[model samples]
Target: MHSKVLDRLLFKEDPVEKLQKETGKNVNDVHIDFNSGQTPQIPSQRYFQNSNIFINKHHRYSYMPAHTHDFIELNYMYSGHCRQYINDEPVALHAGNVILMDKDIVQKIDYVGESDILINILIKDDSILANVLNTLAQSTSLVTQFLVNASKVHAIHNNYILFDAQKNEVAQHLIDSLIIRGLGNDGSNAREVNLLLSLLLNELSHSIEAETHNFESGTDDLLQILQYIDQHFQTVSLAGIGRHFGYNSNYIGNKIKAETGFSFQSLVNRKRVSLAKQLLAETDYPIARIASEVGFSNASSLSKLFSKQIGYTPGVFRQRRHVLDVPRISRTLES
Candidate 1:
């Protein structure tokens, strides 16, 4: 039994379908002017307004070209089934399934019939997303951790997670609430929407049936390796991790590069640099000590890599961050 709101939104002949019926023109021939790139990049500004989140029904009866978007996208199979390709891999989604895609992933959708009701939920603002992730930081769910890592600006790869929520009543109900909140335009605040989204993700995180799909095989092993690196980056070694995972060092190294587009050492350095920045911003640790804590042999090594990665020395970064934080600290104290 569909909710009244879902029924109202699902069965309507949307304008795009109406235009296609009346003029016999496809959607691409109608109003969508894609970029001239080999894989057309869709800008978030095309769909986003003042809010960080936007929801819309997928236009039916058109062959969507292979394209990428600048924002995170989640597609919910509201009542029917559809098929799409992500990174040249075919994925079939049925009713009550959900697919969450990170930014810049190549995707294409097949033409759908009138019964297909796919809903698009675009997350346009990274800041808002970061806030949501922060609220879920304490979660130990692999899905939560994967999302946190994937959302980082320095993420090694773009990926997607598919949830089989067809029989999950909680997930379906939350999806309905999100659709209603997103489409009603009833003076609902962004915080409410964020909360609902947060709850939905948390629920999905706990769903044992949720499946993760990646562009390559051996993703489960890769995720395990990544998680191990994240936990022990300050002291992790390629040889040690290989031994731990029962693979040869050479094989592990090649697999890491093949799956993540980065070498094992590069991934470790990224993690160390990230921690170094945090220590510089929030603590009074000396540069040498911070370097040692983050796995650099000395301050000079950290400084060289920091300059290469961040365009400045650690001292300069710390001083700039302090200068930027003074006003905020003063306001906090006054309040």
Candidate 2:
């Protein structure tokens, strides 16, 4: 399925060799010093430049010794299979698997098969992630946990998350778009890449939330309720939620209050506001579009609620949280 995409993006020069030549060091030499057992040279500037995101094809063979990087790494298995060691624990990865490796997570790759086609997406900055994390702060899904842990700054942690996104079209499209746009010679628009990556993360969050909802436990009623709200806060009503859960509307409200110490409407509003904030911070969509996207009836209603809840108007929020650090490129993407 992804083979055609890989073929389209394929280059004659091997990427691993390209990186090795640019750095003037073999891949193995970049890792731990045998005497010190410490990684002395971190390839902070090789994978990614000043831009927060980097995409490249993985072309390495032989056993890769355990090493850590200063940037977060997303290993997308475009085809074939391989086994990896994350923090000394073996993990088998098949085609269509995407592993999220947090910064400082010690990892080593085993010998790759001849047919393997792996793509590497490295994130060199955390500011690109702040808005995405803040938007999905309410979620407790596996993806959310991975993002939260990856965003942390502690250097002593070893963490990796596997997302079985084989059947997800949204993820596949986003990954392909990222790879294509990144390979373009239009001078590497940082803002554009960040927005595309954020959209991908947002889609992954929804995918995990849906998976969580499908496999929910009977004892975790609050979790189920929150998951429902997370996915449908844009169009969900108290009565609608009650109907889906087989309870009366008033009873549902009372149950949410009892379990979470917050009213049903309050919880819904909070989730909606979080989405609005993310759209405002990460994209250049108009206020009306954002209001509609987050489930408000109109921009006025969104404005009233946003100002009342957040102590700031939506327009002001957008201006203050604007993420395009490059002002010149901001205008280009905003159009």
Candidate 3:
């Protein structure tokens, strides 16, 4: 059943490809409106009217010109291989590889043949992205830290993260699941699509072959510091991290605030709260224990900060999650 669905979706010719074949013209020439702007910026409105996640197959047999868009783009090489020039740098993508391009990045694709299947997954919703980043706050991966920092500030532009997941069966499965879900109902299953995308990103964060390109100066040191904080947030201090990185506390503290718009303590508190929420939802741990486990002094401290940041106390949040999960548990037992 999965094979049939994959074959139909991957092999079938879309309307644009049909037009290209009939007229012997590239997608750019066929769609003159795309070239109206000086740099040819693809607006979110063109493909994202009712959905924050949009999935489309890249048009084949045409040279896609250098252009920018107003949304994050994930290009998955589903089959075969193709080359693209991102920021005038050559990037070759093979089957099972995924590349995430941030907004306003100039990208030009070489002509792709019929056997080469490239899938475009465009995300335009900042709230969804924020939720993903929050869920990943405990991750010590430099890639995750880079993403968190890049999203919070505008210092990095024309940036991209490449994941050479050609050997990662898990990543490939997640990518296929995202494509299948997105292509199924035209945004009717948007919640599921977003969840799959989040899972995919989390998987990519741990990928050993992940690489980030076109980052601004000082980003590497900052990302390393952020990773250290994530790894030691329970007992991390400004002075401690400063010594570890061979810088003074004041300089490191100001840099964190400048790049992420949050003070050092604030970032640590956010990570603690993120872990507290996870434990509350998934464990039977007591509120005080959960608080201490996540680096809080006591339950009150957790509640004060949690309520301020998440608009709910730990007890209330756990109860709400329990209420939401009861029905699903009941349905499973009934079956």
Candidate 4:
């Protein structure tokens, strides 16, 4: 299911040439950070050219050293098996198995055999996730827990979520779609990319079980709340959502705030923005129509919040190809 471009990049490119292009170093040159007695933890934003989403395939000789990223990383095992260490915990990644690792988590990839093929999908923390999670609406499962921890400062240490999709048709299809869309050189915009990613996450949430550490706690009630919000965000109120989940408004609000860092209204706004972005990118509908579709009363209201949250007016954001270029943080940690 891999694209021709992906095939060429993964198989045709010479290892030394690819390494120099990616790391800006010759094969024999040792990294200064590694030579300085510290594990090199590279930030995704820098290596990915500040793009919110980055995807690449790594071969055996291209196996990366022990490192960590400042963005969420999804390692999808397309073929063969890989041995990796996450916070020193050994993980065996078989074909069709995916591991979701959050930002700041230390990991190392051991030598991959000649037949192995693993794809790395790295997502910046604030850009696509804030909106995609709302559309996913799965707040309780192990997958949802990893996403939540990824967005927040507090993370479940030494833990990752695994999804085995070898036997699942829907999961496999979505995974393939993401890989193709992500690597294609065509004019596929960010909207389509995030949409595929959201759908992929939703599909996995339905069929796959999450593997989390003891610290990764999940609640069924939050799942109900998130699902309800996704379905009724256009018209759902705090009181109405609370009633649906058999909880009072105040109690529901507090629980949501505690679990997610977003309040009731803030969460709704995020969901609306997510929908609006999809519409803006995928359709030629008027701004007013897009606003109504995403639950906004009018275009002006939608524009106000959208600008506040995204920094660009809806029209500008769409015209710019749905790519929101937010400022990146420091890539390297101080030793």
Candidate 5:
């Protein structure tokens, strides 16, 4: 059923490149020979920069350094087993199980046996969602950000795909169907692709809930505040946002201060300043432009607020960022 995947990985640019000085022997030099029929097709996004997936039935490889992706990820094990070093947590998963990875998750995967049979789905916040929604909604919902709201999140929400067997079976089939449809649906209905994506999102939401903390804040009000902060990061004002949400401005402000250990304005201001710091370090744009780019109406506002929070001007903040890279506190404790 997934012969297409086999063809795409072999004789193609192997994103799973073997390291020069890895502990195991070099596997890159060995050429794959398929004299009987076509190898198979892999997901096109698999070869895209910063994204790839392979279903390794009996493949083996040397270790790669711990790395991270700027996109959500999912891994399902069909057979065999492997140990994963996910940030500070090390976990082992066998067949019929899976893991949902947050975008900033840093981890390394190591197969325990001859080869690991697994399928990976990598979703970067790109046209992938837009193409699926086929609408102008560009994922601006606050409820779905903290919690997965299937309607907004799913490409096809009203229906679902059927697996009727293993957990691995459904995810694998759905991704494979999408890959084929993406290649050339020709003019056929996209029902197959739509159902596949919706089902995949459902599966992933389950995985996320299972792995993450079962968080239930004493009051839903705190969550509402978080949503408000996320939604209006650019032009969010503590008083205005609080009033708009139907609470007295001071009451809302006090609630935020008590629950989160920060005043309402402080939380939203931190968000803007934090984003500004990122743009400053990553881009070569001028300070005035960077300030305006990060939602400050004027450069003076960014400078004043940045100094209050970070104790440095934007220029000096960027300069000290490289020098003052904070050592991972947990690493120190672990050592």
Candidate 6:
């Protein structure tokens, strides 16, 4: 199921058309149509599989409201002009420009123009790329290493991407050609594809430093504390966790609260709630036992908390989501 932004964008009145009407550009000649499609699940453990390229025409302001996908998405605006909000900030995108958005970011597109045509690619996040990243993180690819870690957040994550239409001929040609070659099941040499990937990162990093000067700013120490929180979601007190980086427990907890707007205990409870849902839908364990499995004190507490967060009791969520709540795996959908 999709969330609120998606529901609004797909069903509500056009926001961009209102803008055009205000500016008197809607002489009734422009036609605005919002389009959407569901992409089949792609196997990301290989090079790249089942990628799609779309070119759409929308005279009205067709918005992509904020939502996070479980994969990487890149956007290139080949023609027309637009302004977009990338992770709650206003970003101007135009012809010969591109945006590389990571999996964790929640963003929406906003633009006012005659026609907006863009190229978007969704990539699997934890596929073969994770393995490649683990290797890249430990070795001489220091810049890539920096980006690999940096790209894992809900913030405007990758600041090192800029596109200049008038300059950088090789990079421009490569971008255009990759869109063409990557669309089909043929004419793409592995060597060229690999080269394109490396060079794309290189040029993106180059431009990002110059144009996207307002990059992400925050505390790295706070981030590590958050990562520790994720690591020990089912844990408590955790004296050694803070000491691993020479931070005191109280100070670490305070930092997490300050940075992420959630107390340490609240974060842990949120994690437990998430895990509880997974267990309810994906396993056959009894409610009382599932509570202990995910570190809840008892079944009553789990039920009360899960209902508050999920808007349904564990039994109800299980029945609605899993339908059968079948004990064994069933292959219901075709690949």
Query: In order, what lDDT does every prediction score?
Result: 0.72, 0.66, 0.74, 0.70, 0.49, 0.52
Error of 1 at 211 (Å): 4.7
The better candidate by lDDT, 2 or 4, is 4
Q: Write the per-residue lDDT of candidate 5 for residues 1-114, one digit (tens) a residue.
A: 456564464323233433422555434332333233533222234334422222222234543335555444556555566777666477676655566555445666664333
Task: At residue 57, give the lDDT of candidate 2.
Answer: 71
- For model 4, residues 1-335, the per-residue Cα lDDT tens digits are 55566556565555664675577543533243545567776744353553466776764554556776677788889878999888888888898888877777788887665567788887876653454455555445566655655655444444577788787778788777777767632334455667777777766766554565645356435556767877888998989977887789999998777766678788788888877876776676788988988888899999999999889899897777645543223333223
For each candidate in turn, the TM-score is: 0.60, 0.55, 0.65, 0.74, 0.40, 0.45
Candidate 1 residue-wise lDDT, 1-335, digit = tens? 56776787777987888887676656773244565558877767756665667777887766577888877788989977899898888889898888888777899988777788899888764433233323444455655555545544455446788888778888888888888778633323444566677678878765544445443333446556766777677889989998999999999998877655567887777767767876787677788988998988899999999999879999998898777662212212111
Alpha-carbon runs more than 4 Å astray in model 2: 3-5, 11-36, 39-41, 131-140, 154-156, 184-187, 206-335
lDDT for each residue of candidate 6 in 90-204, tens digit (9 for 90 to 100): 7777766766665445566664444555556444443212222222322323234334444444344444344554355665666665554454434223223434544655555
Q: Would you give me the overall lDDT of model 1? A: 0.72
Clashing residue pairs in candidate 1 are none
Q: Write the per-residue lDDT of candidate 2 for residues 120-226, one digit (tens) a residue.
A: 78776544234333344455655555554444343233556577778889888888777777653243465566667767776665543112111222344555566
- The lDDT of model 5 is 0.49
Error of 1 at 309 (Å): 28
User: Lowest lDDT 10-mer window, candidate 3?
Assistant: 326-335
Ranking by lDDT: 3, 1, 4, 2, 6, 5
The TM-score-based order of candidates, best leading, equals 4, 3, 1, 2, 6, 5
TM-score, candidate 5, is 0.40
The list of candidate 6 runs beyond 4 A from truth reads: 1-114, 117-219, 238-240, 323-335
Top candidate by lDDT: 3
